[model samples]
Target: MELKEYMNFVFPGLILKPSLYYQWDTRIHFELAKGLYQFKSEIDELNDEYFNRVYDQTTTLFNEIFSHNDELFLVTNVYKHKGDIKRNKKIKVYNHYINNKNIRFQLKEETLPYMFDDDDADEYYTSQFSLKCQKQDIRYPVLLKAICNQDFPPLRPRFNNRGISNYPDLFFINIKKNIIFYIYDDRGCEVIASDIEAIRPIYEKYNEWIDEYCREDTEQLFK
Candidate 1:
């Protein structure tokens, strides 16, 4: 199963968002899962347990996926609420590259617009992970990097300051086909993350598909 199908299996009744204003290049969306209604009744250790378990499960799944392939990497921007919402740790694991071999993962921190003309500090943000496939020539991720010396309209600049944030570059080369995968959490981190089990077989299948068709250049793309 692909992204859409896996989303349904992990957390059903959620759909992708068409567009969002004042947001980054996030073209993804979703809502809370119907299960785990117990949290609604009462918020206690169970809530914390649920969140931790879900996060651990997700991270483990991704760890497995990345471990299996030398050409894939995981970039996680962990957010912590310590009097203020701050990025606790920015991790780039396994492989972080734009060459033909690897695909970099990304998840942007987004905020909701309130009545006031300011980014709401109180509003909890959602999580959306993306996989951007690009050529080796591109120096930076597409979301922040300029294409042909021109930026995509209304650029959501990352500054890429300190090299802390790493995303996929959008600069494509005609030699091979490049793509992006936006798996979103529309519930604003309300529930759990994605299903690795559902994604494994399909992801393997996708690689097989690419191997069968996009030939020769595949090795150059990875290492």
Candidate 2:
């Protein structure tokens, strides 16, 4: 079957890349956002009428994304520390998960822009807001919440990383690699295609890694 770009891959938080679950498309529809400006709107408290509309729309989307039979969504929320370059900063983090045990990832050119990159920046978090994402894997999201709440577990999931693999003392499960998906996450799912050739070569590496892992795992199971 002929599959489209967005539909066969990606979930909500992976908007910097390609996807097909357009709002105008058939069956399910969702919108994408980029940069802090767009999220500023999603994060802010809204008035009653507007909040109702947003709440209803998000409620419908939540139900659809969660109840689908086979397709799995890997929604990841990237969190970086906000204050001085001190270690063990408690930053609020949210998570998303993929259920395929064989799928892996490798990050591309960019890194989290807001994270403290050098000794010059503050790594401490403020009480302004806490990050949150629902409908994630039970194990993974719990880990993230612990980080946000207690600042423990000091190992970040690393991939083909060029810069600092992680912030000092702060850890998160890398959305790029070291994650797995399982069959239970694949009930009514159609994994139309695993890799997209048009993607940036870096991200393509991640997808290829996932495809190869899945292939090898399936082979091993049957062998």
Candidate 3:
């Protein structure tokens, strides 16, 4: 599907909002599921072992939730979330890499009038790549880790300021599956799917590691 068409399905009416907003949208919506990772210390992020596990589980979830041959779009804002144009050093480098790879992207300026005032629309230098469910491709894990830790290049795993790793936002989407997975600040993640059965099993499979608040929020959402 064209990017416009796919995006319309995900964020109907050109309403660019977070997964939380989509969960409540009646026109195009999904069953909400949440997961959390156990941290050893308040100052610590996911250790190597659990980090790899999260990557593994996430990739597995992607593969299982959608068909092997289905088209998947790994979409995210490449913008560094800073105002000073000169300070966009990291995403600038990453943007160069993206251009070299010939990824399809667009520059978006979105404003939520109801939530905010003063015409301060957030600008997003968004990049969207068509992907598949193959585990052999190194892109899946690397990008997933980047989204998790918010690291650019995503090659070496590490945290940024206050452990708030990487970019403005990131999303995993499959139009056919009617699902969108959103990860935030390496903290946790939530998936919204129209068909509850599509994600229920995976959530249950990782229940022990899933954050209780996430679980409760999802439960409350559907109830």
Candidate 4:
């Protein structure tokens, strides 16, 4: 499918432009933020225990919400972290993944004038590919795990050498169910659905694991 066709199919009426917040119809959605805690200053190594727990939970949640054998569209938005003089090459994380995995990708060129108006958007692009479910074996889980582990360039623009936001870099779409799951690093993840009732089971099943700040608001959507 063409780039526009894929966007229309997965995102529908949502605007494809940059925004301070998600352009989702929040009336039927919930934003799950990762809970942050103060770290011990003397820690020698970062403990990703929480990250692993969340990732495992998400893996189970995906299997529950989505059919174990369904084909899903995995879309990733790559950012060119310009101004990083340490690395003066066009990013090729996804390219490496494609070549390593031998998968095809549909590419799209886009610009977030708000984020990178000065840089050419052609260098920053989006890739769309087909991914199978857990029944198909490890490909699906491995890719998502790699993204959460920051194996590729993040999905945010750089300004004065810093990232702009903690937005999700990639998302998996279940077109048939009209649902989208977004992974925003170890900090958190989000799941948006067209039908509240359809997602209530998932919400209830995982409510305890939902970010504390978003719990109340998420609960309100069910009422």
Which candidate has the top score in lDDT? 4
- Tens digit of per-residue lDDT, candidate 1, span 25-140: 21112222224331435533234343333334333333333322223112222222333333333323213333333333333333222212235434422232334332232233
Off by over 4 Å in 1: 1-34, 37-40, 43-46, 73-223
- Per-residue C-alpha lDDT of model 2 across residues 160-213, encoded as one tens digit per residue: 111223422221111222111211110111111122221223223222223332
Error of 1 at 55 (Å): 1.8
Clashing residue pairs in candidate 1, if any? 30-186, 100-221, 100-222, 101-221, 101-222, 142-169
Tens digits of lDDT, candidate 3, 67-155: 65555554544333234453333333234223224332332323222222225435323332333222222255555665666543343
Give lDDT: candidate 3, residue 133: 27
After superposing candidate 2 on the true structure, give the runs of residues whose Cα lies further than 4 Å from its correct spot: 1-46, 68-91, 94-223
lDDT of candidates 1 onward, in order: 0.28, 0.26, 0.47, 0.50
**How good is model 1 by TM-score?**
0.25
TM-score against truth, every candidate: 0.25, 0.26, 0.57, 0.63
Q: Indicate the worst ten consecutive residues by lDDT in candidate 1.
A: 171-180
How would you order the candidates by TM-score, starting with the best? 4, 3, 2, 1
Clashing pairs in 3: 36-211, 150-165, 150-166
What's the C-alpha lDDT at position 167 in model 1? 29
For candidate 3, the TM-score is 0.57
Tens digits of per-residue lDDT for model 4 on 90-128?
A: 224344344324333333344333233545654343322
The regions of model 4 sitting more than 4 angstroms off are: 1-3, 15-21, 26-41, 81-138, 151-168
lDDT of 1 at 111: 28
Question: For candidate 4, what is the lDDT?
Answer: 0.50
Model 2 local distance difference test score: 0.26
